[model samples]
Target: MATFNKFFSSVFLAVLYASSYGNAAPWPTNAKHGTHRVRTLGKGVQVEAFHPPSSYKTYGAGVDLASSFTSSGIEDKTVSYISSELQVDSAKVTFKSGYTQNGQSFAYAKQVHNGIPVSNAVANVAFKDNKVIAFGHSFVDTSKIAPSTPSVDVNAVIPKTEEVLEGKKNEIEPTLEYHALADGSVALAHVFQVQNDEAGTWYKAFVDAHTGDLISVTDYVADASYKVLPVNKELITDGLELVTDPQNTASSPSGWHSDGKSNTTDTSGNNVVAYKGSVSSTTKQSADNLVFDYTYDTTKAPDVANNVNAARTNAFYLVNSYHDTLYQYGFTEASFNFQNDNFGKGGAGNDRIRISVQDASGTDNADFATPPDGQSGQCRMFIWTATNPKRDGVLENDIPLHEVTHGLTNRMTGGGTGECLQSLEAGGMGEGWSDIVADWFSHSDSADVTDFIMGQYVTNDPAGIRSHPYSTSASTNPLRYSDIAKLDEVHNIGEVRTVHPEMVLFKSLTFFFLPNPL
Candidate 1:
């Protein structure tokens, strides 16, 4: 919602993404200094975000707080709502600023304990229909008493902090603030933001009020950057070119190459370990400069498999790109997404996707094998023999995009058992989800749903593999649910089930495209 305010900004959104997103920590300094942030993304309209403080519980759409408290306006009402939720007085909740859009209202407020402000504690609220529709809270405990006056003064701790920070060229005077501890306890801390000459090292260090120990430190350095292939309408159509780093910080806080355990200077990263082979054989693209610039040679024989290195690079790029894209849509670790080192967010860990490009296993089609959450999902992209020179399914962006969605739908359903798609109907729906994923990814425009085709580039067929392109018109796509009774094949049944959902999806989201940020 570019033009709208924070809460229920534009349209089709009001979706909540809160809790369990890890924050950056000290490297040999493992301290829990995580600050939760919740954001809601509507289509292309506007936005809202929710990240509750490190509390025991978080509430969403269903947990209505309308009957709790009342105020003259949304501003005071938001403050009162948070106060009631936290069992604190309304005076402790102080409103900073907010705005209203399309009749929905939102307000941002900070938590205060006995008048001294609490660090990293805030409430972002949305109001509608005379009730608190939804809100994001990251508040500290006011019930537990902290020191009103600091035993360790701000001035006395600078030299000690300076020793830790090496040499501080510029510094913000330390302020006394209440810091929340991992044990659900509160400690009065002196907060300092200092900058140094060492490669522009800046630190937000917290010192304990009683003993003056370093509570937590966040290095305000730049995130890692990379140049890789991005999602275009179709990579085969647009050709290859490395775009600047497209990492989503909310999902990948440590960057793509690092999974908090170790770092990779190549295609192997936290989300995926990509290579070219029948199995785990090595053909990884190593770029110390973080640029994966493998070129596809169309003039060569067996067009796709001849340049095996480029196939691996292309597959690697698609997996990571689609991983971040799905994360924004709530395929989170808590929701059973594939990722190595889930950063203690939730679900299984060390299950990063393993992709094999130009696989010697088979040809003419690609596939993904998804086990449970903790196990790595295997994606095998085969060469297509439809034309004189075969096409690699890896280079066809939608093909890999389709396969990755198979992992998503398989792991997400039936409590992430990965065996839920055993039934013919269930298996058909799984295939349907894959086609829909690619269809949406390749949707030419907002109104480009009726003519969407999957595997067009790989198959070298204008009509694609399925019986029909996903279309609303009965003439273009005549498949109905009753046809599932006649069809025993999963992909065939999938063609039947896909058309109707695409109609529904096209209706819901007025605009659809993944590459651009929402």
Candidate 2:
């Protein structure tokens, strides 16, 4: 059976001794258009952002509000690092703390009805070694203001504030850190002092310092509801069967390619035929009203003559693309789960995948199909004659590419690190990358990338579209993530969308970070 591994647990924040980051890593040598800089800050913190110098203001107006809200509730001198698009002019972006109170609003409320100008908090952008770092106070210093002043020119404070912040670059020890995840995202840890009574509780929060998107936060005290369920082979087999039953006329009209094979009648005299080279008798287990099994064969061509090789080739292509193009390398093998229309039917509590294997001799040889099987023998790409062949046509290679790429990407980054969406984005980016790979596989040269809608290879039978629904097709399904309006759309609607996840990921990669991935 395939294995499911867990990485980081869902918890708010992690506390540890603050360590300075080592010298900044070299920038992408291949990409000439991007610049990389590095710097060290303080005893425990390190800050790294990518982009041209002076291109600080990309965060939306919401940045001002979020910063204000984040600062208003806390008393610590908040130091914020903002990210921005690379190459774009930096002077346009302005980081603000909060609105200024009107002149003497408290002492001369009637005299100064219109509030005073609020000082805009600014950050110092700098480059050290070769990576970029943005460091400075996210708020203005109230001490600089004289009490007798009728009203303070919020504008007047901007210059000195920038100078003080800029000077801190030389005073504080540099944190040698780069964002653990990527550029365009901010890394935050609550300021905690051991000897000082003023230090508040230490916590971690990251924002797309550029887009102002709350990428992730680690509090250690926040409630978490996610669980990492083990990979159940039986559930997978059952789920596959639910979506593709050739004999069952009521099954959806999805399609796939298969060698002629059959699942012989079961003990109940019901035909539970297993595909010839696809599954072995021993791996087949009766569970949850469905026959679950593991199937592997070494001889199947990526595209069988009768069944298109697009999906198979696409899967391989995805694996390769992730490694070669995306700089991700992981996972050793990939498997495709083909099943009938009733795949995910059992009570939600009992779903699992059944795994089975068979040899290439067209025999029910489990031993021959195992590791010792036929000098790296052909594994089951089961040609279940009973499967709805129609659905086979719907099998876009991107689905297999996406699934398999999950394995590879997982290995490269240790599966998941901080957030589930990070893991999910690893998967989403894998899917998008796979989709791109599948399109590229068809081209004669590097220029050949297909524009077909994603998930074109999987069945879209709204009722049973789990295995291969592209982000687009899944958009219409009730169980899928479709709405683009909600922030936490997946959790809010109990569904996840294919497009937006990829979009957020793409936006983070393309616009948020600097030193483009050339």
Candidate 3:
């Protein structure tokens, strides 16, 4: 219930935020009075309002909200305030100019009216939950002021020298376009192609046009090739839809496996059983590629509640651990819910899907609630039974990040193995990178290194090992990239030991080595 409340509350706040600017009152001054109130908020700005108090004639004056009090008409109010300059336009007598936010001066016009600047300027500035209120000589209300950022007109010509970003070979060309939403945030959209044996799909990224920062990306799979079947709508929703692979000509179908087949039981008195399924590929993409399509299942009462809480806790850790310098980022949108039939089937035999879930009171021969090696417990991913309705969402589970990292690394950098010794020999750095990200998400680092492994939080028979270090070894050379050597000389301890004494001079020089960002 607490989870439900929090989820709803967040949704409500977001809706309210998207709704009207609730109590944002306008400049709070009459246009006819040249004498108006001036207010200040903190040190960022001051606002002064002016209305032509006595001008019933052709002359009039108005207040300038932006730093640049650039006037628009031909009447003069002849008002002056501390540290402010006014420029007069002869043709438009009411037209006058003042300072711009950029520190350059600009011109504006006002109607003929009273001669003194307004006073008693109370201002209100909204921040996160707190309103900054102040009084100042010049009242500059910028709350409703919008900036005119640089933008290319839609029909503008593309410069021959203007380079466009591209994807790799066999990839669909990106669709780049500038957008001005009817509601007004300028955005840029870029499309990329994604291919599966069944069919090809497209993904899009949205960026802030003015800032060039990625705001979001939407995944799109062609409905003809893939079907989006939803099983749960109450609490969770899956963005990716599941559909049968057109390339698959298989005739046989196995019932989705359930946890009841195994000894696994839910001790929390929740609907304990789970579901699992997979699609077989005609040919393996790679040894490191996702062995099979994904599976999902619903959590029982307490499981639902527990998982939601866990999601928030972990999300907080991830958000704080990185991007601390910037006040907010994508993680602020953390949410928890179940998903079903997320990915479509693949093109032959049994599909291998990874399953994980938290065990309650160790009834299912699962690991202790806490890690054995004093490592912190990580969120786990359990296999979903096909019959089950609720399955974990990527945001709700950390496993997706870890497992997806492995898949991405394998795809991006040629397939690599995760075997301890061999990975140390050739793929150790990659392996460490995975672990670093996994641990880093939990805000764990070398300074706070613990014995937790990638899947330690899974409620599996034996909890995954947590004693793993980023590198298989350690080194005395402070400047060397911490690799397998930092943990131990296991790769070739004897040879390394023997060569160390004879090559002390070379080894000492290693101290000056600095690693390049990979």
Best by TM-score: 1
Error of 3 at 408 (Å): 13
Top candidate, metric lDDT: 1
Q: Residue 250 in model 1: shift from native, Å?
A: 1.4
Q: Give the 10-residue window scoring lowest on summed lDDT in candidate 1.
A: 41-50
Q: Is candidate 2 or candidate 3 better by lDDT?
A: 3
Global lDDT scores for all candidate models: 0.60, 0.22, 0.23
Q: Write the per-residue lDDT of candidate 1 for residues 1-518, one digit (tens) a residue.
A: 22212211221121111111122111112212123111111122211111223322223343555564544576677777778777888888887545444565555567777787665465556666566565555575556657778887777887777676654625345667776665567778887765543222455566788888766543322100223345656647666676667778787877777755887676678898877643355444445566665667866744344367677666766788888876765577765788888887767888898887776667787777666577777777777888767777777777788788878766654334353343344455567767766766665445555577777777778887777878878788877665655666668866776676433355444322101111
TM-score sort, best first: 1, 2, 3
Error of 1 at 323 (Å): 0.9
Ranking by lDDT: 1, 3, 2
Estimate the TM-score of every prediction.
0.55, 0.25, 0.22
Off by over 4 Å in 1: 1-229, 278-287, 302-306, 448-450, 501-504, 510-518
Count the clashes in each prediction.
11, 93, 67
lDDT of 2 at 470: 27
Candidate with better lDDT, 1 vs 3: 1
Cα lDDT, model 1, residue 24: 17
